[model samples]
Target: MPTTPRIADERHRYILEMLQEHGSCKVAELARTLAVSEMTIHRDLAHLARQNLLRKVHGGAVLRNYIELTFQDRAVQNHEAKVAVAQRAQSLVRPGTSLYLSPGSTTHEFALALIQDDLQIYTNSLPTATALARSAPQGLRVTLLGGELVVFVEALVGPATEAALADLRLTHAFIAVTGVSLEGGLTLYTEEEARVIRAVIRAARKTVLLTDASKFGQLVGPQVGHLEDVHVIVSDHIPDAYRQRCEQHDVEILLTADLDVMPTSAPGAAAADRRN
Candidate 1:
């Protein structure tokens, strides 16, 4: 293993270029490719992730998992955790209320978990729209924001979607993110997705976040909003770091394990379904 400022920068460039070409790279593979130890590769990953150049997943770093979207791929990655988070998030919905659900596998499942009727649900996720439409309770209204579908992500983005969000009002906005940190707030793998999420939050009265434990302290492409912008955070587990940050910002955390905690500190009423 070699250590030098120039070498480190070049290695970082190489990793980014590699991800751009191959989508992802394993730690051991990167180590072999760069003629470095796994420790060096891990250090590079940490550096690159902090720079917001890539997403650090278990055992590797990824360019944009969004580019590899598939219900089967996503619906199963953290199936139980996603379901638990979604199930807890479902409490935010009430009949006849409006919601904005951004694109994400968990948000798609959140759509599936909703049983409320006469709800006006707006979204940019193709899968989410379809899921809610097929299983929607009576009187459920689904609005798919019109825009250019992002490649492999099967989600809409661009001006049309942003413009649509500007004209609407929502009771709640439930979005999924690739990362959340005290430094970057909530982030997505791409700036375009981040923009759409920002718009969704802007249109809603309150914001709710849906994610798994892996996203707790992660950093990715770009941020949507800060911790204070979020009213509730629903996750399988809330890391101590995140819990402390949320508490400082007066944000409520709903741990999916028990679904007992509510966003009591937020301006509006705190709510969720109880579990043992």
Candidate 2:
């Protein structure tokens, strides 16, 4: 017999495999096939959903086709850069304010950074809630919004979650976007996820866009919002042209390093620095 923790982990993997192979599955059927209790299957589905592995439905789960990477695939990309971005994001949070975190790898890192703080966190990201629940200080309050669980991102969204967010106020919101275009603004792959992100932005007093250099100009889907919606843009590096665009929108850009001592006034020069 597997230990409890091991069983839980295996159950999660099994659920992911089932979704991958069949595109969907029923909860009760999954329980019967796996020889686990219905409650156990429910918990497993919830956990996998938090990782954005699949979307939980009325009776089972379905794979999110718009999201390209599996949970395992995302774990390996730019781990160090994500950590650096997470650390920078954490620096913006003060001790006892309410914060909202959107679902994404970079924002997940930011959630991890809040482990020692005494704060109130509201999120649709199951992974973020779990990370905060397990590691956040004792006095910290973590609220998981109600909605349809998106397995691919391990976050909740939909009418229910959006309704829940309507009553709450947040001091800060850290949004992880799939792509940032100078003209198209901030975009994401899924419309459902994009809606949730828009709610996060609206509920917060300050909105911070957290992304790495690679996310720039990579248009994935529709624009979630414009540069004007965000207060600060935090990235590893922003080319001169992009930086100027952000500045034009009254958005402050923070780069991890100083690219040049004598900064050129031309935004076009900044765009030219990209190394192919």
**What TM-score would each prediction reach against the true structure?**
0.73, 0.67
Runs with alpha carbons beyond 4 Å of true place in candidate 2: 1-67, 258-276
How far does residue 44 in candidate 1 sit from its true spot (Å)? 20
How far in Å is the alpha carbon of 31 misplaced in model 1?
Answer: 33
TM for candidate 1 is 0.73
Task: Estimate, for each residue in 60-103, the C-alpha lDDT of model 2 and write its tens digit.
Answer: 66665545564346646777787777776665678889888888
What is residue 93's positional error in candidate 1, in angstroms?
A: 1.4
Task: Tell me the number of clashing residue pairs for each predicted model.
Answer: 0, 11
- Residue ranges of candidate 1 with Cα displaced over 4 Å: 1-72, 262-276
Distance from true location, Cα of 1 in model 2, Å = 69
lDDT of 1 by residue, 61-95 (tens): 76653453454576778888899889988766787
Q: Worst lDDT window (10 residues) for model 1?
A: 267-276
Best by lDDT: 1
